[model samples]
Structure formats: structure tokens, C-alpha cells
Target: MKRIMIVDDSSTIRKLINYILRKKDYLITEAEDGLDALEKLIETKVDLVIADLNMPNMDGIELVKSLRNNFYHIDTPIIMLTTTRDENLKKSALEAGVNLFLNKPIQPNLLLYKVESLLEGEKNE
Candidate 1:
């Protein structure tokens, strides 16, 4: 079973994603924000991390930087989700080491597809 960490400030979004991934039999871990997610990562080993761009107390960009700098998570795949269409923000995320960026109002099938593709690639590697 693949483990995934979801970091978002919105409870509704967290629950929605948790529901979707749970149905696929993926182990789900939820964090209210980047800070919480970082704490969780210290104790939990996750195959992937799905995070919202705008979050309090660190934000997704900072989290990505932290993860990339950390030896344990340097190769971990990260998918950043955001409602913003800002090209600069997207560029920043890419530079910060995000593997993929998905816009908000994400379609369930698309999310699943990306998640599966990334995880499958990881397995192949």
C-alpha cells in the first residue's frame, strides 16, 4: 500500500481528497498545513505528497524546499495543488522541486491518473 500525505488548510479539501484516495486503497495521512505536514513526515514514510500552494505557517513552496533539502525526501515525488493560475507561482513551484502542479477544482480521474503515473514511475525506478 502506497502512503500519501495531503497538506492543506481547508478541512473540506482534505476530507474530499482523503475520500478519493481511500477508495483506491491508498493509505491517507492528513495535515492542516505545511508545518503539520513536516511534523508528520518526520514520523511517517510517504511515497508521495499532495499539497495546496497557499497554506499558513510555511506554505507548500517552503515545504517543497524543506523536503528537497532533507536527505530522506530528496527523491520523493511532490504534486502541488492550487487555485491560483499565476505563472510565476507555478514557476516558483517548479524551481522549488515540485514534480507536478495541478490546478484547483481538480477532476478526480485526472488526479488519480497523475497519482498513479507518478507512483508507477517511482516503482519502476
Candidate 2:
């Protein structure tokens, strides 16, 4: 099974995502923010990351940049989960190497579809 790490400040959202992704048979891991996510990323092998933008100790954009600059996680898939729908932000994220983006108030089916598609693509690659 593919392993996904969810990095969010909200405990409620974390639980919701964990529940939904677990049902799909993906191994789920979580972090409270980008810093935590980085630590987790170093500690284990994660196939994908779903990160929130507005988080303490570090934010999603910074995290993406860090991942690119850091020796590890160069190819790890990142799916930005954010309330900000600004085209500029989306463009910047893509430039930073995010694999996908999911808006806030995420729909379960859509999340599943995006996750599956990215994972499937990775599998094909």
C-alpha cells in the first residue's frame, strides 16, 4: 500500500482525512504542521504528502521549497490542501514541484480520485 502523510494544523481535518484515506487502504500518517511533517518525512518513507498552507512552525509553500532544496524528498508527491485559490499561488506551487492541489473543504470522492490518480501515475512511472 502507498503511504501518505497529511500535514495540517487542525486535528479535526487530520482525523477526517485519515478516516477517508484509510478506507481506501492507503497507509496514513499525520503531522500538525510543516515542521512536524518534515520530521516525519525524515523518519520514514512517505509516498505522498497532503499539506495545508496556513500552518505554524512552517507553512506549505515553505515546506515544498524545503523539500526541493533538501537532499531527501526530491520526488515525493505533494498535494497542496489550502483555502487560497489564487492563481499565482497555484503557479508558484507547481513551480516548486507540487504534484497536485486540492482546495479546502475537500470532498471525499475528489480527494480519493486525486490521490489515486497521483499514486497511479507514480506507479506507472
* The candidate that achieves the highest lDDT relative to the unseen native structure: 1
Model 1 C-alpha lDDT per residue in residues 2-83, reported as the tens digit of each score: 9999999999999999988887999999999989999999899999999999998999999999999999999899999977
Model 2 quality (TM-score): 0.91
Candidate 2: residue 29 Cα off by (Å): 1.0
Q: Pick the candidate with the highest TM-score.
A: 1
Expressed as tens digits, the lDDT of each residue in 36-66 for candidate 2 is 9888877888888999877889988889999
| Model 2 lDDT, full chain set | 0.87
What C-alpha root-mean-square deviation, in Å, does candidate 1 show against the real structure? 0.9
Find the 10 residues in a row with the least total lDDT in model 2.
82-91
Which residue pairs overlap in candidate 1's backbone?
none
Candidate 2, residue 6: how far the Cα is off, in Å = 0.3
**TM-score for all predictions?**
0.97, 0.91
Candidate 1 positional error at 31, Å: 0.5
